[model samples]
Target: MSHDIDFAQSAIRTIKSERDAIDKLIPRIDGTFTQACQIMLNCKGRVVVVGMGKSGHIGNKIAATLASTGTPAFFVHPGEASHGDMGMITADDVVLALSNSGNTAELVMLIPLLKRLGTPLISMTGNENSALAQAADVNLDTYVEKEACPLDLAPTSSTTVSLVLGDALAIALLEAKGFTPEDFAFSHPGGSLGRKLLLKVTDIMHTGQQLPIVSLSTPLKEALIVISQKGLGMTAIADSQSQLLGVFTDGDLRRVLDQELNLHTTPISQVMTTQCKTVNADMLAAEALNIMEDHKITNLVVVNQQNKIEGVIHLHDIIKAGVV
Candidate 1:
């Protein structure tokens, strides 16, 4: 089949036009946007995001973004609200309604009830004079010059503007609330981000007898045995008091071989790296990864406040745990 170059060119032109529209829309995020943010931030309860059709889809994403970014929010379809879902809204909550036309009948029907409940309403709309916008406590203008669609009928550019506006609102609230990576991690406990931000050395490190360890006076052969059995490629060398003294790795074995030292007879401590990097068990796994990258090393010993070896973490363990 022959490719339609015209279709591709038309699509590219549409995208460029939409991008230009969005660029112009950025300047409109001024006092009114700030006011909307203030209202939502000071709201005593959750944000109820409501819309219809394509706007509803965008509203759902907006609600999720807001919820994950430290704002309490949930999407409530306007059609559902006309039924029993309106009960989900309360006097303490704030409603964020999305509509390009700003006159969606299902949403307009809830304005009176929302006002009766004393809930604040924020509207994202292209039409400022429309009922939804005029009735709202704050109006966020999401007007676009035209839809990316050649016919100017499809939601394209308008929906993109609305989504970007929603992201702006979420990020503003996130910054206002001082929401940190640790807080975001708590809200996203099931993903790789959660592991990186929330999981600490203690959560994944091998402890007790599982830790490959050898006394500083142990023979190189004995240390190699510990490393082999544990399959960690390294052994923590500790003093008689069990304080971490150094680390012996496969790299050290290579150096030992180069020096013609007999692994069977030499003391492991003689070839170990004394200034090995160590981390606290309470440190985030992401932070640990940074240390590893910065030091150009793979294995790290989890140490206590007293600098005694508590556990060990290999780069492989971090990868397995989805921390990096």
Candidate 2:
């Protein structure tokens, strides 16, 4: 037995419907959208998002996106708000309500209370004439021509438009506030992104006695021992004032091996790479990784502005810290 259904065509229709719905939203991102953004931007407490059913689900995600991107926000289920969660909202906050019908009972029921508390209301609804939209300080019209659902009863294209609009609002606010990737990383500190943005060379570099160091007069053979003992595959050659002069790495060792020079008798300065790639201790570890990749080297010597050796940051240390 075979089915007549064209699964790919059905999916394509749904995707196109949602895409077109999002395109319609572009024109709606005008004065009202700007007013909504201004309200959230001026909010001192947080952006409290509330909705019912599918709208509620999208509201949760929108709140999270706002929170992670510099605008502090959180979701409050409208049903729960009627009971006691309403207290979570304050006059300092700005309420962002999501309802395709514009009159979700749960959300609408809280309008009077929201108004009484002097909390600014921003609504995303398909109907501009909705009670929620009328009551809101600003309304974002997320109207959709039709649902992607064949029955046209399910929240399909409308929900997609709401999600896209929510993302647009968050990103616009983020840009207006001058939000940076570093600021975003602070909100997601446990992830790899956090490590990449927050971990500085000083945080991962081998400092103090842990740094493999050798003097200009140290024998090439002795510097090799320091490299091995420190297990960094490299050693920094500094002057008597601890000023960085050069660096000797495992790669350099390979090149030196091809030479007939006596490792035991030759001074490290003669064999070390004088023009070494170095990073400041305060430089982001991710940036250090970029420098290392650009130079095709595995380690970097951390130096101060005065050319004084501070620490050694290895590619391994960056990888271990999840900044790679």
Candidate 3:
């Protein structure tokens, strides 16, 4: 076979091997997984994750997932833990240790100190009988049939399985705690996903004098001028009390033009849409986007619980907020 063909075949075999490894890991989630989740869930302090080498990389990601999903977690390098990083651990913290061989010297050596501090240890190892697993309060078996590596030396399938296992644990705890999207947003405020879940119409809507608003008795010509000045493409028609009466838009102008209505003389109330869709100021920005798309409209009148005009939210506002 040519060199390129050999390389392609090797890549395919590696994928197939890892796929089978994950398939094997499916049946490994049992009471032990529950026990591990329970320990971390009931932990008063934090879940401190530690691993050596390749396992350490996976542990870092696992720690992030756990922390984002409502479980407080942080990763500490096992090799560094012995060199004074163990001070980061405490009596109230639970330790999650990952080691494929289960006899990794750095992690195993700290079992006694963790015990002395009365900190619970959860171990993920390929071997159930290994010293680390035996020393742990809960053991999560991450055993795999074989390595995807051709030499069976380099870490490959094992690391992938460990990551998948970590995800399972994080999600399980998230559901157990009734974690909500708003709760998740608190952990990821800088991300677009967080903005979508956390942002409200009140956060991005055009309010106060910036709102394109006109009285019901105002001429259509003047309402169009308000829309042009505010640049929101729509204007709210309200009463003296600021109670929402209706909405007039560029689309309303189009239809009025088609009907040969004179903008200079027509009352805006006669041309405005009385049944316009509206959203509460407190509504999630994402929900407002859904409302706009569902009604095939671009702007919504934001109101308070009293149905008084609060502000207006445009499709552009939601999109700019990264909610769309």
Candidate 2's TM-score reads 0.89
Candidate 2 clashing pairs?
A: none
Model 1 scores a C-alpha lDDT of: 0.92
lDDT of 3 at 96: 96
Q: Look at candidate 3 and give me any clashing residue pairs.
A: none
Assess each prediction's global lDDT (C-alpha) against the native: 0.92, 0.93, 0.92
Please write out the lDDT profile of model 2 over residues 189-210, one tens digit for every residue: 9899999999899998889999
Give a tens-digit lDDT track for model 1, residues 182-251. 8999999988888888898888888998999898779998999999999989999988777999999888
For residues 14-61, write the lDDT of model 3, one tens digit per residue. 999999999999888899999998999899999999999999999999
Backbone clashes for every candidate come to 0, 0, 0
Task: Tell me how candidate 2 scores on lDDT.
Answer: 0.93
TM-score of each: 0.87, 0.89, 0.89
Candidate 1 stretches with Cα past 4 Å from truth are: 1-5, 23-27, 189-194, 262-265
| Cα RMSD, each candidate | 2.9, 2.5, 2.5
CA displacement after TM-score superposition, residue 36 of candidate 2 (Å) = 1.6
Q: State residue 56's C-alpha deviation in candidate 1, in Å.
A: 0.6
Leading candidate by lDDT: 2
